[model samples]
Target: MQIVNKAVVFESGHEEYAVPIQSVISIEKVNFINPIPHMPLYMRGVTKAREDLIPVIDFESVLYNRSLAGEEARLLVVQTESLQIGLLVKDAKEIIDIPQEALKQMGIAAYEKTKYFIGVAAFSDRLITIIDPDILVSSLEGIKDIQEYMKQNKLFPA
Candidate 1:
């Protein structure tokens, strides 16, 4: 018997990326994102979802070094062990089952930022870069600063 992992595929720029479906809480359309001061450039701001305020990050900027243009961007609400944050993506494509065998370990040294990627998998006719949400959330610049802001603003419990 083999284990099959499910992933939510989304588009960012010209490439496709996947995150384990188990980590995803919901997919949401872009709504009003209130900008916060003194946060990282990639940190778009905060938004209310399901009666809770969540910080949203511009994943395109974090991954591609540029913010996404236009109004078609969507939010991928991901929940980790400690935190739940919104990741801005171009679009949410579909949920697909990827075999464990199909995932290939990527050489961390070869990539400029190795922490952002977990592995690669073949889906359809393209190779999708699998994103590690934990790393992505933890590695963001000014995360602590944002957390402090949230706490000060009573957005997060101290």
Candidate 2:
């Protein structure tokens, strides 16, 4: 008898997508208790977790140029070098294990106009675009202002 196989599964944009579980960090409940004024549209708001106020970055809006349409969202905590940020996902799904061969490089046309989505991975009938949080944070004009405020407040890195 022959048997079929399943692959790495994850939640993206409220859909069931799959990727290597190795790329994923444990999902957490988004704390919507804090709010900031004049934040970019991609910034849903700020939340406090473990005594740190982390900015919740809206994933879909940043990547697809869309807005929050009332879809439930979650916070994906990701670490990039020395900086750690929370990714605001509309819906985070389960983790699945798939073959690395399924991954492919995204064409330049997809990012020639914008550097938002870095790459895409195909799983089943869905296409999942890998979001680079650093790019979003670095490109944000408010970052400098925030940094300045932090420096004035003595919160700047010493």
Candidate 1 matches the true fold with a TM-score of: 0.90
**Each model's backbone clash number:** 0, 8
Query: Tens digits of per-residue lDDT for model 1 on 1-158?
Result: 11339889999988989889989999988878999987888998999877778899998888778997567788899986557888889888899888887888777725756576888886568898888787777777788888888888999667
* Candidate 2: residue 119 lDDT (0-100): 50
Clashing pairs in 1: none
For residue 33, what is the lDDT in candidate 1?
93
| lDDT, model 1, position 86 | 89
On TM-score, the leading prediction is: 1
Expressed as tens digits, the lDDT of each residue in 1-158 for candidate 2 is 01113323335456543323333354677656354567667766556555655556666676567764444666776544334456666666655433455555667625544454455566677666554445556766566554454456454242
